[model samples]
Target: MKFQNIFVLFFAVSMFFSTQNIAAQSDEVVINEIMYKSLKAFDTNDWIELYNPSDADLNISGWLLKDDKDTRHFAFPANTIIKKRDFLVIIESKNKFTNVHPGIENYVGSFTFGFGTDDMVRIYNSNLQIVDSVNYKSKSPWYPETDSLGPSLELISHELDNSKAQSWRPSYVMHGTPGRPNSATHTEDEGIDDMLLNVFPNPAISSINIEFDTQVDGDLLIEVYDVLGNKVKTILENYMQSGYYNSYWDGLDESGNPTPTGIYFIKVKSPNGILNTKIVKSN
Candidate 1:
């Protein structure tokens, strides 16, 4: 009886230590590289890649990529297993891929959605703990040089161009070829000289408000464009004072008729340049 008791005690202790080791190993999994390919200057198809360096597979089930207000959640299937030292590509559109192994398909579904150019993307683990994030309000280093149709992992070197998107910022770049460790002091270009425009009550039912900030008095043109770049409505087309301004659109067309439910662009053009943001109308 004494020997049996000792044996059971030893087995219990061994199990406890084994569980601890597994936990420790999971905590060590780190993002070795993050690359943004198939990009354009101000527009893209919303695709990204994540690289892992550890040997153990990453169980990203229940992981989420969210923005402010935690209102939008991009959920990763629990069965998803990212192999060690491999790359995972996520797109905002749904398409079939033969490159992904059969086991991985059960966890990661086809990319079907994307965040807006001015929104935020926060990556979280199974425990709802934040692992990585990027804000579109800042200039991201990983800008797309070409479309995704070129190659699987083709990417361009990061450049410091102030003329392009200013507020977009890159959240992370893993340590690898085409990936560089970003500096903590790095920041997007100052937006002081640029006019910031915003529209509210998006997914707007009947009407919406347009707002912008300027430094000097100048002519501001606020136009609504469809996906095909056709002008739908002009909210403002004359010179305005150098201050905050508001304009309301009552879901009308060029002839003051109700427009259909669809996606539209709100473009604000000034002497400096042009800025376009998206708005959705429903009902």
Candidate 2:
């Protein structure tokens, strides 16, 4: 009788830790790398790479990628699985990605979704619980080169905190090393004059502040675009001397109505270059 009780207690303890480990593995699936801004010269669209660092296969069937404001989501097909310590890429256009790199089988998604120069990428499980998320930018602190024909952003190491901008760097090669271990180890450019774009209180409820500095005097154009690429608000468009400038957005459209809660892109065009950042409006 004593042996039976001891066995039951041991089994219970093992199951408890086993359940905890599985939960940890689910959260371990990280947004490894992002190729948000594809080179204009290349025909490929945006793609996001994911890494599974757990010791067991993860059946991510029904998992989905949520975009700004949940405007659109791409759910994983039935029976989709990512093996232990493997890589999978979610592509915007499967045909385009395949045409460039053939035989790379660990990929999914051809959703009509596109990532902006500055955008957010989020993943959720079947239960609608967030698994992992990453917000990337196209300006300094971020790899400015990634804004256009530059290399894709690669996480320095999967063990690092990917939520921080400093944890990422531009891929050494153009496009990026998708479905493979990252080999990018380049130093951040210190000589370049960054625009220093700053958007405050992301996921803003009522308003947001945009602050930036211009190195040269020229025409500055700032506009807000909805998820569908519609011009919702024109924040500023004026000729200003090279200096620091601050602007505000009251979450209203051209018609003076409250903008819908969703993802919005703030585009700032200055003499230096075009700086794009993302802002989320919440109810």
Candidate 3:
């Protein structure tokens, strides 16, 4: 082969790889959460949260966030940086958003939803290239309950496919955790044991059921905390065999008596991370 032809082939190969690298970089920023329908009186502003899943800082300045119908549009600020694994919240109205969350100033407001419950949101880079697009509806796949309820639909894993409804879930709290990690965000740190705790009959009249799954063998600790962060009950503290297990809390504290009403937190500490959920006790 001629040297000139070889050089031409090399140049073309490098350009192809360069374009692929740019496309991958643009896709690192993902749509992390959406609050199309909000129910909180104090937080009436609907918002969408973006996340940088890549290890490098992503400059999303001048990027376009628009709905499929071209109704809602948002152009990001110049040189806006989404740090590595960080979150940026773009809201519909700044006044309503800041009115509720004053400390979180990392929000871009002044955009309104142009379509109804079912619509698509697209994110495009400065060169008008598609980064990511999410088509969300008020039906299956997406959380249907969040369509009218207070909680927002939060992406479970940005590393997962966002176009699927199974990738999202209704936030555990109302209005969602804007400008922060989603309530359903799972810890992917593999250094520790992975665990999940589920408590049913939250507003229990007498007893409650606690089920948990463990991925690693470790000392498992189960405790109950009041809304004030006071340790109310110690359910278990033993070296557990990893897999799946169940425990019961008869609405009793460490003293073997009934607990009070209101809200209580069930905390399960494992090697992976801490698992927390709420259970309401009523008389």
| TM-score of each model, in listed order | 0.37, 0.57, 0.62
Q: Enumerate clash totals for all models, in the order shown.
A: 13, 0, 3
lDDT of 1 by residue, 1-283 (tens): 9999999999999998754422222433332222233233222244454445566666666776565547667777656555665556454533322222223332244445554535545667777777755443322343331112121122222222212343222332211122222221121222336677778998799998987887667788888876445789999899877778778888999898999887677777777666666577888
Give the higher-lDDT candidate: 2 or 3. Answer: 2
Error of 3 at 116 (Å): 3.6
lDDT of each: 0.53, 0.79, 0.77
Q: Tens digit of lDDT per residue, candidate 2, span 105-221?
A: 899987778888778899999888999888878886887666665468899878888989989976655578788887454322221264667899987999999987877778888
* Candidate 2 residue pairs in clash (backbone atoms < 3 Å): none
- lDDT string for model 3 (226-271, tens) is 7445799898999988798989888888888878775676777887
By lDDT, who's the top model here? Answer: 2
Error of 2 at 49 (Å): 0.4
Look at candidate 3 and give me any clashing residue pairs: 141-165, 193-271, 193-272
Scored against the true structure, residue 236 in model 2 reaches a CA lDDT of 98
- Order the candidate numbers by lDDT, best to worst: 2, 3, 1
Clashes of 2: 0
Give the Cα error of residue 138 in candidate 3, in Å: 2.4
Model 1 TM: 0.37
TM-score of 2: 0.57
Candidate 2, residue 162: the lDDT equals 90
